[model samples]
Target: MGVVPTDNELTGTVRSLRTSNSGLGIPKLLATLLSSQPEWSVSEKRLRKVIQRLKSEEETNFHPTSSLNSALDVSKYSNKLKPILFGPEKGKGLVATQDIDAGEVLWREDPFVYAPPWEIYEAQMAGTASWQDETRSNLTKGKGTSNKLGDESPLSKDAIWDTYRSFATLRNDQRWSHTSENDLARSQLENTFRRLHTVLINALYLQHSESQEDVTFDSTNTGSIPAPSRSAAHTKQLKRLLRVPIPEATLNSLFSWDGLMEGLGKMSLNLEAHGGLFPLHSHLNHACRPNVSIRHISPDGSTNSILHSPNPSRITVIAASLIPAGVELVVSYVDPSLDLRSRRRELRAWDFGICQCGRCLEEENSNSNTEHPEISGNRTKIEGGDERDVGQLEDELRGFLSV
Candidate 1:
């Protein structure tokens, strides 16, 4: 051994190596460091100790708990409804604490995490400046484009991690239980991250290319436009960004993939549009003829204004009809106008299985009775036919009911 390297020197070397090559393994890092600094005589065991210490320091510095805790507050809405376990199959649901009148607001909540749909992500990757403006205009006119929930921007790694943390705290889903199944899930998550990473990199490259064109060309020039391509400078900038290390804990936990899936599962069950994961709103179970309706609202309580506003929207739960005390609050997961068979089919696709709501049960009983030929005939037509045929059958059924 020559001379032992100082702790500060060893720490700096390790940090530099990690910054240059984030995926470098410990053995390789040690060998590379020793080779570069032949004057230093550091043992492999000593270098390992320094590496662990640096990781611990980084983890401690990266706490987002304060912001997360502030955003998750539901104290204002706690008195209106309470979570109650119905059974293993239904899991936890919300019940009214007091009688709620029709049109009365029950609760308003912000999303724990928000991600735009694939279309929006593609637009961002393509560097389309007009996509957001068009989407906002459509939403204002009540001609909303997509049913999927999401915010204005493309999904970020930070948002993904936040979603994971929210799900980990909830611990309501059975999928959270760790087993051998996680290996497959982890692989899927890695693929998702890789795709997202590529999208972000490509978007950055395109943005830079556009800026370069603006600088190099004048408006008076009527020359043919050149195709976009990534420059060496853009690649260097992206490489620097990609080298930033992700927290070790986040990589190992559900946030990597399962947490994202859980968030999506909850979104499907709860939200209509304006993608977000509202914790309090999620407890309300599904019913065909539900007593409540959910909608997105701006901070000032304007329903339509949320579409174009830069501020995040909140989900407002309103009583559609009179809900008595001690009753469970529910909302329609799909269009309530759909016939029994159609409704059941939609719910089944959502993994809700057969709906056992009171209206559904009553309809099922009515269908079982041979006395209702019109109702049975309409159901058969809807099951076998397209939307136009179903609409025609519905009109015929309405005529019979009127008589």
Candidate 2:
């Protein structure tokens, strides 16, 4: 008589089989188990019971509605700063809840989704000989590569689900919406998605390649390895896993060409230098003279001390100057030292139009006065006239201008 399999052993086998073939029915699953483990005696009725219990447990644990609630929650950071609508034109902005002293920390937040540099992503997609050589050289030197999280890492189903959820949340969030219908905005949206698509394609390729390599390595080391070549069927399974099943409507809304472009535009506006999008930090509007300073710091607040410390994922918002309660917190999106015209030009290119900040207004007014026709005419007369006349005219103009 063959040895009868215990309930625990049957449950474990069923789980492994289901993980590999999610669509396998109870009858087929039992047949596969029996064929593989011919020495073990198991009844089809007992196997069916185990599968049903597992399905019930999965249904109870996984709630689709709450999958993203934790990722989108900003309650922890709400005590110091809050989002307030600044009218239709300006939309929403962050405001200080109470008087904040200079150098005080307002909040620290992690990026919703962080990506590697555009150049790196492009290189990976192209798979150029130079890039391959560089990667090999770095490996030889014991140097770390650009995509530490992605390179040679086993793809986790949970990580893929989390990434998809975060992206979906970003796409649906109305706070990041831009109501502009200008050609410049449209151009920017297209460009943003062009780059995003490249990155996504390259990421998928990398994961698939890494998974294949893992399979190859395991087969070489162990005599008993399943799916030696990681066949097309297995590849299909991996692609399905990476895709993360979502409703047709939700998928269309998140990934349709127009939807993708719009989503990328929102990300482009708020993405940090290293391609990170912070939730609360995105609410701070631009200012010529910003009251808040943004800093990337390690958990202990010292980045330089740790060699190759992972990209300082957490950003600290410090009060650059004393900020009064209920005041809108702002940060400089461009260099503050830039002159008025140069600053305005840069801002315009970014679709921000002219800045109306106090410093910019004062500078613009001063420039306007200096260029006034009367002032120019008086200056010209003074330059061409005799020294005595020039002095008299200067005195007259100064008095007229109340200088």
Best by TM-score: 1
Question: How do the predictions measure up, each by TM-score?
Answer: 0.44, 0.42
Q: Who wins the lDDT comparison?
A: 1
The digit string of per-residue lDDT tens for model 2 on 37-70 reads 8898888888888988998977664221111123
Residue pairs in steric clash, candidate 1? 149-275, 150-275
Q: Mind giving the per-residue lDDT tens digits that candidate 1 earns over 1-403?
A: 6778788888998889888978888888888888889888887888889989989987664221111123434566757776777754465677888888899988766666664433444433333311233354244323454434364223332333334334333332344446678767765554554444443333333552254223221223223333445578877998999999877877755474444434444664544545666667766678999898888666676765444345444667889999889999888888889877767766765546678788887887776632332223332333446423343465457558862
Instruction: Please give the lDDT score for candidate 2.
Output: 0.60
Cα misplacement distance, residue 281 of candidate 2 (Å): 0.8
lDDT accuracy of residue 340 in candidate 2: 68
Q: After superposition, how far is residue 373 of candidate 1 from its true place, in Å?
A: 17
